[model samples]
Target: MLHRSLPIRASLLLAALCLSTPAWSADPIHKETVALTAGKAAHSVKGQIKGYATAEYTLTGKAGQTLSVKLKTNQPSNYFNIRQAGQDEALFIGSTSGNTYQATLPADGEYTVQVYLMRNAARRNAVANYRLEMGLRD
Candidate 1:
């Protein structure tokens, strides 16, 4: 009787584990506002992200201003990208090894910096803590 009950116990445990974890679990995208001034202005933010999570920052600058963005994370599978205001695509995409990008503002107005964990990493139940640094150099 004891040997027969062992299999049922293992099956119940497996079902409980599966039910505890959802395929997708995350909050809404987090957003932060920022500002850039000429001649070495900088800003920094820290946050934690779970699987399938994203955080974004918004700022406005002149047409000719140069902007730089860098992200440091506990997990190496996170990156950042830049999207111009009113545009549907990113101006530049960062690689897995390097989560940084710099460019001159093309038409001024507002821009968005999006930080997210890679799709593979986000699919897991891991959480990554990160620090994002943004700056402007005149």
Candidate 2:
């Protein structure tokens, strides 16, 4: 009886896991560096991602400075997140908070900006054409 129930329990666990939302930090499929003009503190970039694809942008910033990010996309299911390098959790979740993010730096180092579509949209092979604006100010 114990051995028979083991398979049943494993199947149930698998079902539960499949029903949960996907982990927000999917491995990015694209990467780029956010470059600022010689004297400028802000810049805007455009790109497109589809399905479960993700684009990551890295930028360097100093502690005590403020970082601002705005994402405008063609699909409402598209979103972005911000995280410091070597971190697993995100500092901002666009799907829950909104498309814009603003926060003061926590340390002086590199940060990543990730853009992708929600699972619901990604599973449907939806595409997101987006303009991402970023700035850092003292």
Top-lDDT candidate index: 2
- Per-residue CA lDDT of candidate 2, range 26-134, in tens? 6448999986432365799999999999999999988888899999989999999999987788889999999999889899888999998998999898999999999
Q: How many residue pairs clash in each candidate?
A: 0, 0
- Each prediction's TM-score against the native? 0.76, 0.76
* lDDT for 111 (candidate 1): 87
Against the reference, the lDDT scores of all candidates come to 0.83, 0.88
Residue-pair clash count for candidate 2: 0
Name the regions of candidate 1 deviating beyond 4 angstroms: 1-27
Report the C-alpha lDDT of model 1 over 34-134, residue by residue, as the tens digit: 87776764788999888777898998888888888888899978888888988987787875337877778898798898888887887784688999888
